[model samples]
Target: MFTLFYVLSLAIACSAVSVDVSDATNRIANGAVAANLQFPYAVSIQRIANNTQVSTRGHRCGGALVTLQHVLTAASCMFEWNADGTRTPITIGNYRVFAGAYLLSNDTATERVRNIAQYVVHPNYLGIPSYVGDLAVVTLSTAFASSTATPLSLPANNYNPADFTDCVVAGWGAATAASQTGANVEQKYANKYIYNQQECTSVYNALQGLPNILPTMVCAVSYDIVSSSCHGDEGNALVCGNTLTGILALHSNCAATSYPEIYTRVSNYTDWVRPIVSLANSFTSGASVLLLLTLIQMTFANLLS
Candidate 1:
């Protein structure tokens, strides 16, 4: 995931006003938010400190409400450690829809922000050693408030990776004009070039200098000029032909061309995902227990009466 300071320092500026989808396609400036994005699938996350208050002002990353109860995001977003070794609280809901000034119709377009009841980072994800296993699932206290809001797309049961030849990556990271933060985070769809492990490792060989890039990671290069994940775009979705197959996680670095943007292969983590989603349902099941208890109490009261 790109850091707030570094991504903000870049010079990729785009206006926040309504932009033509054509201009956004070409990447004339920086990028544009989706014109008629019926379901706002992406969410802007806010981190809060142990004081149980919003602290550590930082960049907003993207995520998907895969189920009514679970959210998928880049593990790096939660790996940040405090002196006490505790992770911060992540805020999710329609409240974040305000990010790109697309709030006029938010009543119908946004996912209601919900607090995470629990979270699970891929056990193998090494916080520092390698950021590759950078996937995590957040179970919200309640299922997201849904309307016409887009739901998370699940990886096809037996989908072929090679089939995803091209895709559009969208986010609201820092714009290029160094000092000016764009009015809202925007989306720009880019033509992506899928990179095989051997190829991507070779391209980014200078950094890791090893052929260790795993098949679990997918790399994509953008045809749109000045288009790439920057600060604040971490954990966004890489929608390939409308089917979201990956969660934006890493790249050589934010705004780097030689290094392709990397994502957490959704298919690779499906097994680990099953259990986390199961736990999310437990919260709802607890409510069922409460209802049962209430019923029993009512019967007892009737007998006493």
Candidate 2:
């Protein structure tokens, strides 16, 4: 975690906004408080420290449940790349996912907590300072039985982010640019629109050390761009219509206008994610052969993308 200082510093420099890298759980910037069960797929990925269930302090990243056992999030949530271009992964046991949790304190009856069994960061993920291939699929220690939490629907094979409309981003990121301190207990969400890819690229590229936006990444913003997603929202889902089309890779200054947020397009990685969720769900269905064939098909689609 100490090595992340360099990466966090780089991000701060690029945004020209003060960012407190200490606690990961934060409030949404100028967004509405979400109704309970409204986003049953929203999950809080918190690093275990102190008595967690009711405690209000810890590092956390936002994520969505893609399956009872698998979660889709950003690689930046699980690993950190060093200045030397090497890497370090957070211990699997250090963090846990809380699904069906709208409020941070006392919602255990509705919340399903799970320890992470393992995770798969995209093979091409370059970690922070680079948002390319930022997605990761995390497997839970055990699958949840019928619960209040629901798995978010993944994008279609032909899902095009350019066609994305009526999207929403939900998280516990800070509400103001001035706050890099304190704790936020409830989840919040904001309506967003797909921002122009080329335009977004130009804006960030102007920042000296930032990486170029790739085709695999999608950009989004509020109607007025001033109210946007913030730092601690990393790894949360960007749902458009009824499908999960984006996984937040890097957030913009929530208090700044015109700078849009970026996410790794879920459509670009559907091929990689499909098999994991499908195979796990099909193991007891006696359809291994058909599943293998479908996996091969998705592989081709990903290659073409």
* Per-model TM-score on C-alpha atoms: 0.68, 0.79
Per-residue lDDT of model 2, residues 1-305, tens digit only: 43244334335534643233234556777788888778988877776665543353453678888887789988887864355555688778777887766776643552367788778888998765676788888888777665657887778767875643779988887776566565536778888888778766766665665767888888887775555677678888999887898988777656545456778999889988998777666562336567878999999999999
Off-target runs (Cα >4 Å) in candidate 1 are 1-29, 36-39, 48-59, 81-111, 177-183, 209-211, 252-258, 285-305
Residue clash pairs of candidate 2: 26-172, 26-173, 27-173, 27-174
lDDT of 2 at 55: 51
The lDDT, on a scale of 0 to 1, for candidate 2 is 0.73
Instruction: Give each prediction's root-mean-square deviation over alpha carbons.
Output: 8.8, 9.3
Q: Compute the lDDT for candidate 1.
A: 0.54
Against the true structure, whose TM-score is highest?
A: 2
- Candidate 2, position 204, lDDT: 66
Best by lDDT: 2
